[model samples]
Target chain A: DTAVSQTPKYLVTQMGNDKSIKCEQNLGHDTMYWYKQDSKKFLKIMFSYNNKELIINETVPNRFSPKSPDKAHLNLHINSLELGDSAVYFCASSPVTGGANTEAFFGQGTRLTVV
Target chain B: LAKTTQPISMDSYEGQEVNITCSHNNIATNDYITWYQQFPSQGPRFIIQGYKTKVTNEVASLFIPADRKSSTLSLPRVSLSDTAVYYCLVARSNDYKLSFGAGTTVTVRA
Candidate 1:
């Protein structure tokens, strides 16, 4: 089984539309994170959820929202998408109480395209 | 999250040992240095991590000095598959912020 998986490996929509990307982890991790990779291929942290608590949030747009129903899942919802929003979004997870196993496992990624 | 400085790009030959060094001058005392490898269209994968001294895995090795100002990731017997973007990051034990920079893109030639 894949440790971390993302639904809708690719997405395409027009500008001003709303879309959502789903992520899940079966590795029993307590913390989940969202990262966006732009055209420059720089992976920037968008949000982090530790046991349903938002701990790390970067200077992202208000149209983007992250919802974590539980530790295993973290969903990202985008409203009024723009052409600049087209990029690859990745989901990662790690154990909060772990020390040696602190490496984050990343999902396949969702390539969002806004025309 | 501590800022890291590394080469923007590097080139190596197959079967050669590739060493990529990352500098984190203002790294915190509790922060650990880690390296990740990313392919063209895939997410980054953990390579190695160390607080200080040396740490080695089956795939790579991490070397950090006592001052902890910088670290080096050494990959032995590189191949074409080893060519990828290598990112260096510094974070606390429990920190969740992983700020990835424009990592050093390593291209291995045959």
Candidate 2:
């Protein structure tokens, strides 16, 4: 079984169209995150949810929103897609403790292309 | 939050050792250094984590100086399959956002 999985591994749409990417993890992690990797292979944090609560929100535009129904799933929705939105979006999860360190596991990215 | 800096790419050969260094000048006291590996068309995988000195595991080893300003990931006898992008990150226990920089892309050749 895939520890972390994302649906529609690839998405290609036109400009101004809205789209969504779904992510789920079976790792029993309390914190889930969404990261974007641009063409230069730079990974940037977009948002994070700890037990379904929004914990980290980067300086991303309002068009990108992350919704976590539960601790295991975090979905990202993008509105009014632009050419600049073309990149690979990845979902990740990590077990958090009150004062301990842990690592995050990422899912196969969803490559979104806006033309 | 500690911002990290690392090389964009590196080259290595089979059966050779590879070391990638990451710098975080403003690391916090409770921050831990972590490294992740990513292959083409796939997400990143956790390789190792360390706080200071040295920490070795089955796949790799992490070496950190006393200052904790930088860390190095050492791979022994790397193979062609070891060619991947390696990301260095520094985060505290309470931090939620993991700022992944343009990781060092290790290319292991024959």
TM-score to native of every candidate shown: 0.97, 0.96
Model 2 per-residue lDDT tens digits across residues A1-115 = 9999998899999999999999999999999999999998888889989999998898999999889988899999999999999999999999982224668889999999999
lDDT for predicted candidate 1 compared with the true structure:
0.91
lDDT of 1 by residue, B1-110 (tens): 67899999999999999999999999988787878999988999989888989999999999999999999999999999999999998888667777787899999999
lDDT of model 1 at position B63? 94
Give the per-residue lDDT of model 1 (tens digit) for A1-115: 9999998999999999999999999999999999999999989999999998898889888899999998899999999999999999999998852234569889999999999
Model 2 DockQ reads 0.62
Worst 10 residues of 2 chain B by lDDT: B91-100
Candidate 2, number of clashes: 0
- The list of candidate 1 runs beyond 4 A from truth reads A97-100
lDDT of 2 by residue, B1-110 (tens): 78899999999999999999999999988888888999999999989998889999999999999999999999999999999999998877867877788899999999
Q: Determine the TM-score of chain B of model 1.
A: 0.97
Best by DockQ: 2
Q: TM-score of predicted model 1?
A: 0.97
